[model samples]
Target: MKKLFQTSSLVSVLNVSDYTVALTWYSAWLSKPDETPMDGMAEWRIADNAWLQLDATAETVKPSAAIIGVNDLAACRTVLLEAGIAVGEIQDWEVVLSCDLHDLDGNKISLAQIISQQ
Candidate 1:
């Protein structure tokens, strides 16, 4: 298997210092960003080639994490707490049913829901 440059798209970047408060909390927690090609960056096309970039780093030095894989983690945490986003509460992590979030430069998001009969 020697194919290393044929891959197309797959972005997963999460680095924000302050691009207008991370574009207003990732555009209401990953909503209005189908594309924003430049100017601090914000793109979300999490499928066909996969993407989820929200990069605007003047460079800090800590707090950075990401884990998003949700089918229905309590209805996406109730639509990210009704667009006010402070989502964290849906534990029971035996396999996967998790929740934890922290934006506003504290970047430590997680939203998992994968317990399909295993």
Candidate 2:
């Protein structure tokens, strides 16, 4: 049988206790304001089809994690640091380089730079 549907985009949600703080922090981290904003949520267009949504809630929520591929892990880390965001050490895993960063609510964002085979 033919497929009834096909996946197109991915939207990841991160729940936070404070919407304002999260929005500001994420905007700076992404270097762009949220493309969509609602009463208690904000969404950033990370790529052509990928989006990152921040949701505000009253209950304690566990931090969300997402892996974003970058062209230069070291440069990205430096930029984040200059922007005042704390970045973890970059790790070389034989096939890829990666680093982890946490948002204001402690949500983990893993940044990976794929090794290009020449």
Candidate 3:
């Protein structure tokens, strides 16, 4: 069998009850305004090909979770703190450093920084 499709990008969605509030919070949290790809939807470009989408919904949307890799965990933590977002203490796992945080809708976002091989 041959590969039918190549994995080129990823788009993760986090549903929220309040679109305007979520948009403001996410814009501050990410330090960038979201792009409106359509009505009632906002998207943040996480990387070159990765995106995080926020959808406004009337129903109770389940909280979403994602693990994001960063180049500097400490720096990221500081930024989050300065932004008034609470983040867990950084834990060393021998191979990487990680911390956890949640959004307004209680969606979990884990951040990890890989240790470079010496």
Q: Candidate 3 lDDT, tens digit per residue, 5-86?
A: 8999998888987888888788877855458877778888888998888888547788899888899999999999998889
RMSD to the true structure for each prediction, in A, is: 12.1, 2.2, 2.1
Rank ordering of all candidates by lDDT, starting from the highest: 3, 2, 1
Write the residue-wise lDDT of candidate 2 on 1-118 in tens digits: 9889999999988898888888788888776655656677888888899988888954777888988888999999999999888899999998999999888788999999999878
Would you list the C-alpha lDDT of every candidate in the order shown?
A: 0.81, 0.85, 0.86
Deviation from truth (RMSD, Å), model 1 = 12.1
Query: Of models 2 and 3, which has the larger TM-score?
Result: 2
In model 2, state the lDDT of residue 91: 97
TM-scores for all candidates? Answer: 0.33, 0.87, 0.86
lDDT of 1 by residue, 4-114 (tens): 778787687888877777777777766689988998888888678877788785465366787878889999899889877888789987788989988877878788888
Cα deviation of 37, candidate 1, in Å:
2.4
